[model samples]
Target: MKTVAFYRIGMIICTSSILLLLISSLIYNLLPDNDIPQMLLLRDDNGRIIGDAPFAPSWQFPFGTDREGYDIGYKLLEGAVYTIGAAIIISLLSFIVAFGIGIIGGFSKFRVKSFAHKFFTSFYFIPQSIIAYNILYPVIWEPMEGFTTTLSERIVIEVLVLAIITVPTTAILISNETEQILGEEFITSATVLGGSPLFIFYKHVLPHLKMRLFIIYPKIVIQMLLIIAHLGFFTLYFGGTDVCYTPFCHPPKPFIQEWSGMMGTSYKELGLSWWIFMGPLLCFTVTTLLLNGIVKCIEGLIDHEPYKSKQTSRENETHSFESHSKQEKFLFIKN
Candidate 1:
């Protein structure tokens, strides 16, 4: 087998993720957070959708503007903040729920484990974005009197929905892993030695499972972010809201900048201003790739023997072949 060095691979992936993270941070820091809505509404002399004046890429406006006079550069940065932030929050929440449920359910009494299994299985089957829109809509979003509604409640709903969806999966993953660990020889030995279940789990199992947890973590985050992006594609907003703020109500949407929302807003003009689409698209792609790389690295590191053993086998084969050649020469000389 072609063996890969897990440590080296992890280092490369970590470096890449860091680079993307830095770029995302820089993109967010340079842009004005408050004036984002107004920037998107920028127009030209003819009332066209041109972001800032002159529509040029400069130190001030690195991304240029759009047909609607919106500053593409600033918009991209703001969108990055939203999408990336949302993904992170969603991922973190999901992981927690997943870990909590999975660990408890997996290790719980039979009745509790059974209930958890059925409940999360149902949740796992349901599309998270749909749940985000359907189950939590009424509880989260509040309709406004006059113009478009705000996003506060809806964002909450979105997070809740995402958390729910993630919890089930996370629980399943963690539980399965925990179960396997609990069945291991060391775990069994500790239990036989009068170690408390909790103590063994926390001290022995959890410590050993750290690498596996790392492998699963990025995947969970990636899954949630993908769902968020899909919702953005549908142009689903909190209730009747358009953007984060409507100059009246402040919805939970303002709490985080969503790349999906930015992409949704500019979806129609994607052909005209590819940058509008490209900016968010690129950000999502890079983030996804980075997360994926991290997961692979973790898995590689944890399961180093898979590839390393192959290299060893090949070396052994070569050594054996050399030994056989030397034996033949010695036999011929003796003959």
Candidate 2:
């Protein structure tokens, strides 16, 4: 059989997951409530309710349901946009900022690079999840009266906070990678050949950097996902949390059906019903696995890509030299 790229498998899995989630979200919006099952309790053939809502994993409900009778699977599908979509957005924003800063740090003087490197290196010691939770809790958690900020505004603030916290660490890694690439002899050779900084970078440096960025991008996405999940554990969910602070303290509710939100709200069910917690937890695990798989595939692709290019170039050079040598011999010593 011919060789097949590992990245294609990753792409298929990723694309199918996203499309499934999008379709579920679309169906949720377009279809009526009756179309989607919301069973209050288990019913017998006689149509008499036997058990309460929040059913366990059964033929009727594969993933099970929450206390409100909403299917865990359906909620996951609808919330995929909020969860994965937001992770992607945050990662992209963080990447853009880190990439710009990294380019400067990579190209700038020793002092600038050193300061940046040393300063940002300190952030690595602090756990990202803890930082995200503290920063997000105040803004997203509803007060006694109600939320001061609108849903969109709160989401924007949360996204920005998450993106910003990641900037320091991501930038440092990018800067280091850039520095390594710039240290290559070809870069110096290109410079000696009178290549402009922009030209040398675009032609030689960028191709290498692109591979690193590809590897880095998915890693950042995975990181953002973990941070968001941690925030969820703290009940600092995205789209804000609505808490009831009355005499009977009702549990906080999430504005969206997000995976993290699902986990945050249903974590208490771990004692009473473990399946609810498992639903979202499994989702996060699968998503993380997929992202990690993508990372592996990309690394594999990068590893082989250079070898293939070098081999091809060598073959071409040898072929050209052999042809030229033959031509010279024929012309110099013809009978």
Candidate 3:
């Protein structure tokens, strides 16, 4: 009960946070103009550029401002959609690839399954971040001729690359689960009864796969988030990286203002204004916790075998009683 309650609480908090982000994203996008100020030109009586300098946390700006005077809070709000949306898209795409491969491969002959297992296993040892960065670099890196890729194109490519990288691991997991399900007596009985493989799969396998997907989907999202963050730490931001060649090669900046990129870009300023990086870091940490909470909720919903067993037992008892009562009534009426 305690465990169940914890999961419930976590679900509420996480769901709320996710919903809040979605709403904020919606509102931010709906606004006519939501651009971050590259330089908020404010001056004192002495005619100094006060706004360009970083400021500590204050009542006016709760989260503080960065070196360029961009509001950390506002940037977080703007970037929330990109960060969360990218993770979601990557997770869904990965799941789609995994589901197709896992189901087909799991149901395939032993030789096919063995081949696939070996193929995917070979890539599993490689780090996901490295794979993602390598896959994304060519597409995201700006060439000397100037910007060729649009934001949408870069984002789409990044999502696809991220999704593709996870397919092997996710497919392996799904294949294992499907194999276990195939070994069940019902599946064997269906096969013996002359049910076609497709028929049996549709009737008996898809439902189980759906339930498994519910539990695994959030985990995939979390994994993608970690990978994105890792890539950001290496200065490979989502969308693309913009490099300035003038004046001793400035650090590459993210095309879009994402939370991970925010942390990466502002990491150098931690000594002067810790809040710049801390705001996004806190956002990432909280979002991760909330996602973990969601995972726990999913586990709680699907993992309670004892409760399911008890419910099934009670249902069987009720059906038996109903049948017995009907028979007794029929006998009495005949008499």
Candidate 4:
């Protein structure tokens, strides 16, 4: 199949998965909370009671049951909104901060631009996962003593930290793009005509950046998802982890039922009930792949004409600068 065909196929699959998750969440919310049926309850052959038993995939429970006897399928459905929604929110916030800093720095005087470039360049080298984890650890990690934070508070802190960590790198990218746009002859012409900075930016830069934003936004979402997964692997699930003391003191439990948290909380079952880990792992993999596919589609649709024009304009600008320098040198020699 052609590359574009593959992208289209990916887009379809990804879109369908997202839609299914959305529908599932909507249906789940519509049902009265107390009226929700227990679908993953298990009983012994002689009808003895067993709490939270593990089971493999079967006709009745397609995705199987976790160690807690919760249906993997149901958990996935319930957590989809939080998992995907959080990533989208973080990505959008990142985009806003990035564009704001980037546009301002790109158009600002030399000192501001230089400082922004250097700062982000240095920050870009540090691993984003590490940064996110450190920032969140202090806020999310429950101490052995002192007051504990509420779920809503932890969620707020996590989302804000995740969003903030992305700002520097994203802003650098926007700054570079903005600088290139500023170098174009049209931008210079607009400035020469007494166009205010805001007017010129709105008229010239934003239109060019809109398509670029479409391409970059999905990538930011994917990055956030990966970071969340990375944090999950470390048992630092979003919304923080809860302490459990039943059947011996177990590891902290995830407060949110999102896929990453589910995977983190259920990781202990990897040996006993592999299905639990696999279920959320599969969801994370498929969701990220779908996002990646969408990105490829957008990339394929990107118009190269603007890039070509930008390149040409940059070369013209360089030549003009050189010519102006030569004239200055000739005048100095004549004097």
TM-score of each: 0.69, 0.86, 0.83, 0.80
User: Model-by-model lDDT, in order?
Assistant: 0.63, 0.80, 0.81, 0.78
The digit string of per-residue lDDT tens for model 4 on 123-173 reads: 768889998887888777666662277888888888888999999888889
* lDDT tens per residue, model 1, 1-335: 13456566665866566557657766667756646533445566999975444344556566666555566656666556556666677778878777777777667778667776777678667777786666654544334543332455556656667776677767787888888877776566556555676766666667656667778877877887677777666656423333343667533332244567666666765666566666677777877888787877666665664434345434533554565456653334553
For 1-335, candidate 3 gives per-residue lDDT tens digits of: 77777776778888898989978886997799988654456688999867655877788678988877777889999989988888988999999989998898888877667876988897778889998887888887776676787989888888888999999999988988888878887667556655577865765676566667777888898999899998888888888888786788868899888988998898887887899989988888888888887887877866643444335434533554465456653334553
lDDT of 2: 0.80
Cα lDDT over the full model 3: 0.81
Between candidates 1 and 4, the one scoring higher on lDDT is 4
- Which ranges of candidate 2 are over 4 A from the true structure? 1-7, 30-36, 307-335
Candidate 1 local Cα displacement, residue 211, angstroms:
1.0
| Pick by TM-score: 3 or 4, better one | 3
How far out, in Å, is residue 159 in model 2? 1.1
Q: State the lDDT of candidate 2 residue by residue for 1-335, as single tens digits.
A: 01235566766777577667666776675666624468787788998878988899888789998887888777777777789889999999999999998877877777666766887899999999998878888899998888888999999998899999999998988888878977887667556555576765665666667768988998999999999898888888888888887887778888877889889888889999899999989988988888887778777666655534445434533554465456653336668
CA RMSD for every model? 12.5, 6.5, 6.3, 7.0
Candidate 2: TM-score?
0.86
Q: Indicate whether candidate 1 or candidate 3 has the larger lDDT.
A: 3
What TM-score, to 2 decimals, does candidate 1 have?
A: 0.69
